[model samples]
Target: MARGSLVPETAAHAATTVARATGHRAQVDVTSDGAALAALGRTPLLLRVTAFSMFVFPSSMVIKDIGAAGTVPMILSCLLFVFWLASWIWRLHDPVRVRHPGRMAGVFFVLGIIVSYTALYGGWTGDATVTGLAAADRWLILAFASLGLILVAAESVKTMADAMQLLRWLLAGAFFCGVVGLIQFTLRVNPMEWVQLAMPGFTYNGGDTPFQARGNLVRVAGSTFHSIEFGVVSAMLLPLSIWRALYDQRGQRWFHWLQTALLVFAVAATVSRSGTLASVVAIAVLLPFLPRIARQRTIAALPFVIIALFVAVPGFVGTITDALGADTSDPSIATRVNNYPRVARMIDAKPWFGVGPGNYTVQNAQEILDNQYLNTIVSMGIVGLICVFIYLVLPGVAALHSARHAAFPALRCLAGASAAGLAVAAVCSVTFDSLSFPTFALSYPLLVGLSGAIWIMVKNEGSSPAPATTTPQTTRMD
Candidate 1:
């Protein structure tokens, strides 16, 4: 009797010890404290560099020495690079990690360089003058290089959360800008001028202006590349809103609905076919993913709500239908289709590195060609296309992986929607590259969103491997 009691008691003690050890291991945060700071510092710096480079260019145009204007981004980039290096060195002892599709993305990004370098060589024409270089095309070249670098670096560091926060900032900014545009329409004012507030020296000067400005609606592009580019930005936000809607509860996160609605209105005010089309496409793709409960609830309320809103605002239904119209008379549409085949033929001649970045505008004599894929090939070459491919593909891979591991439905929706949105946007890009315009900053956030999704996916997935051994380690000082 005594021996039996002792055995059970001893077994219980041993079990308790093992359980404690297991809990300790599970709770451990393998990440050294310095790792996170280094990552964070590196991540936001990318945003700063991009904004500085592009924004400075426009304001810099004000300065006579173009080189001085150009040097701003260069200096910012160098400074950011220095900071990143020092931070990495501080956290050098921490383990570096990345999972599957991210690896594939990194590989693809490098491959795209072939296309970039091809463009660099093929389009040079032994005339290396910046003045001789394609004016708008110069931005294209910078875009390619920047995107390639951003892709590889983002993947290498794996900063998904940082990306998400940036995207939120982007979408919120876009939404507010959309509101300003709506306000402009209400006040019967120039929307572009209002957008210039955030970007002190920014101004929009082009559009299909006629004798009456009404025929030539100058959509407020905010800090984006162009009004048309703003359309793409608006399109990108719709999916983000949907993702939020799917992930968040109405009571806890009503802002998702509000933001989404405002975004839709923004899209309406822009009157951009591409932007509207992108929004419709993004929402349409997201529709099937709605939960049965949400879908049912929406079905019950949506009809009445939509009808009420339409009745309250007579122009609402008309605006929607008008937007949906596939009236082929649009010259911009016709112009794009007509130019495409010619650009394709040009690609046939210089497929490896199509022409040179921004050369299409110059070669075509300062025209808004408005085709991203064609422009890419024409500017950088096959190599440029490859690099562009890398920039887009890696984030997608990260998003897909994130979707697989997302603990929250909203996060999953965000990840999936961003991925799908990018996919759709890429399709749009083949025909249109809005990132080139001075008013188009929406693409920046979209890119960041995709990159952010990847970072979240990686971080969550990484944590799964270690469990939650959350120890306080000194984060490397970035």
Candidate 2:
């Protein structure tokens, strides 16, 4: 009789009711198909492919002789893009209606890169290492691939279960990285060497080993291209691991907590100033939103963790402290400081749209600007820099908005975790050329897309009609 008054007793009746309310039988059928798909209990194809490409293989590995363009994740992203495009073209009805702000921002950011590249087309000088066209093409491929990931992930994740699964995959990947890093640190050996031997056609582009040294202490990169990248990635994922540890079911709690510990140890293994700072930033952003019990537990564990780190790694705490306190005399600090004047001149030449993406090579510029924000300015100009901020920061903002309004505690925790992860990425961008690295470049967009999906779920939950009072209620994951 009245809307939201009918209590369907059969599958047929439920479908009929849904069809009447939506005025589309096809929508009901699509819902049934989606349910059938979910019943299979397999990870969504895009999510699986992404996790495998990004985490299973070392980020430093590429197809033999293909260079940056041949990274496994990039190749998988391109394939996923084609699949998404074909699906979009073939779907005649019941298309996804969610319009996420993060998705819109990603589109604009990609467009800004294209605009900059078009403006500088053939006028750029060829460096001794890479041609201008080649550099631009490489960057464009990366930009497009990133956008493809954002779109696919946002569209594919249709429910809370999908979101949870995505997080699980990410956590699994981070755990793998952490374990590999700990091994590298303890054994003073690169495990990727064994991995390379096992795999054919994938070669390491990262150089002799995944180890770097500060004085006598050794730094480990795990599966990432550099120790700094490894540190930043661990810092970003730490919040998610902590969220799982605190909120996941009791049976899985121990495993998640172990994952959290591994990530902390991995970060310490890197001995990176930015990584340590990024970890602190993640914790600061995440702690305020966690429940009282979680917050208390985290605070209480801090002293023990610090004591363990001291005993386990010996000089780690002092190394991080000294690095943070280092003055301009420090080589890294001096390099960053000295680049400002040169970067200003470069920005002055073409303030609106600079030389072009990937054109600012160390070969031509004579120095590497570790700051991604500065790199964005030099390569894509002020407009591109603004776009970069929007693309990176908007998802976290959206995640926070969802967390504030979400009906379920689990959803809220997830939202907070996503926000914290993105915050780490945002803060770390200033400390390194984060996007230039394959691991972060791929991981960041996937997280953004997942956050957009979380936002959509919150919005959909808010818009749906309430259930009838007479019906027996069961808990919903969302």
Candidate 3:
């Protein structure tokens, strides 16, 4: 019996036969188990995160009625706290096998302290700190905590299998979100409001009621949150879909094409400038890595564009031009430019440490903090900035290294490209306001998984173990 990239059933049975002859029945079964888990374990973590309830439960039609508006996300955060608690308990039982590697968690703890302390200190200078404990602050921070919880659990406690399972679920939920977004796009409604009325604390925001925004057609964002959130949802799916298009399970080629087309339509229909642009840019960046046929298919798409334009005549082309040219005019770009000098002057008042968590948004007058970098600097101070640096830069570097050198060379192309693409988008986010969207909380974990998977796969080249097989493959999502 020979081992191939794919372990056919017959190959496994032959190995089992060999094991039986060797008087190793149990060992054969263990080998089979390891093989099965290995294939599954190779999927990327971002795909698994789709199954995360924080990503899923809110999208159903019954969100607000179920009392889930902020509640669902909140509970998801609590689940993180629970996960951490369990890790601590598990460590108590098996200290060696389950070392509390809070290596990642320690990074976050330092960040939280820096940001919180800076935010508080910024408040002390009283240049522009505004003080208040509001629901928005609580909800957003709760979401940030969820990211910390995921990394902490992933690094110190979770096995490769646990990571794989998470990606599976993340993909599953993302599929449903695509479905729900499709439904809303087709029907022009918010399903989360009506679908699961029994679930509490959920509120549906991903909808439009024939509403016009600034004279353009207002689109429904669906279960993801807002119009921008809809964009983020589409953005997350873009990479995974591209991954499947380039390298998928053997028989499902056409099926994956349909999935890709469906995502494109769903994203286009959302009519979100930022979301649409982000989705397009992200996928376009991935196009170079796609298979020749897939790449050609995208290139050949131009005729459809011309035909759609032909059908539209003047009405179609004009609307698209208008929509594309839609007013992103920063009414506030000028405001930020004017205000930041004063704000920076104020920040010079106390640049060492920031005000603390929630302080820039809370203590400062509402004007000082729309951008994440500016907000972070004003709130956390120099120490806070350094903490954020570790959180973002380290994982990004890890992912880049792995994506670049994956053992399954074809897998290397897109995983590396996607990691790089995400880094570009993340850096852009520092100056842009879109990071405030759900994608930030939703995506950081996926990035972590990619980084970890790439690193694991590269490190395990030629090794026939569970981590070697699963790390790269785990990236394949629902």
Candidate achieving the largest lDDT: 2
TM-score rank order: 2, 3, 1
lDDT by residue (tens digit), candidate 3, 418-473: 45445544554454443345545545555554445445434544343333343223
| lDDT values, one for every candidate | 0.47, 0.72, 0.48
Is 1 or 3 the stronger prediction by TM-score? Answer: 3
TM-score each candidate.
Answer: 0.66, 0.85, 0.67
Local accuracy of candidate 2 as per-residue lDDT tens digits, 304-390: 998998899989888888888999998889889988999999999878777788888675333789999999999889888988888
lDDT string, candidate 1, 1-478, tens digits: 1212312134334333222211212221214322321233223434433433433233222213333223333333333333333344454322144234433453454455444544455544334445534353345334434433343334333333344444455555656556555555566564544333444332323332211221334354433334556556666667766555443322335676777776666655555667657765666555544444554554586467567646543465565465456454756556666776777777777677554454554445324567666666776677777766655555655655665565433344556566656655665665466434433422433354344535534455445443232211101001
Off by over 4 Å in 1: 1-82, 89-96, 99-129, 132-168, 191-223, 242-256, 288-292, 295-329, 362-367, 404-408, 438-478
- Candidate 1, residue 145: CA error in Å? 7.7
Sorting all predicted structures by lDDT, with the top scorer first, yields: 2, 3, 1
Q: Given candidate 1, what's the lDDT at residue 155?
A: 36
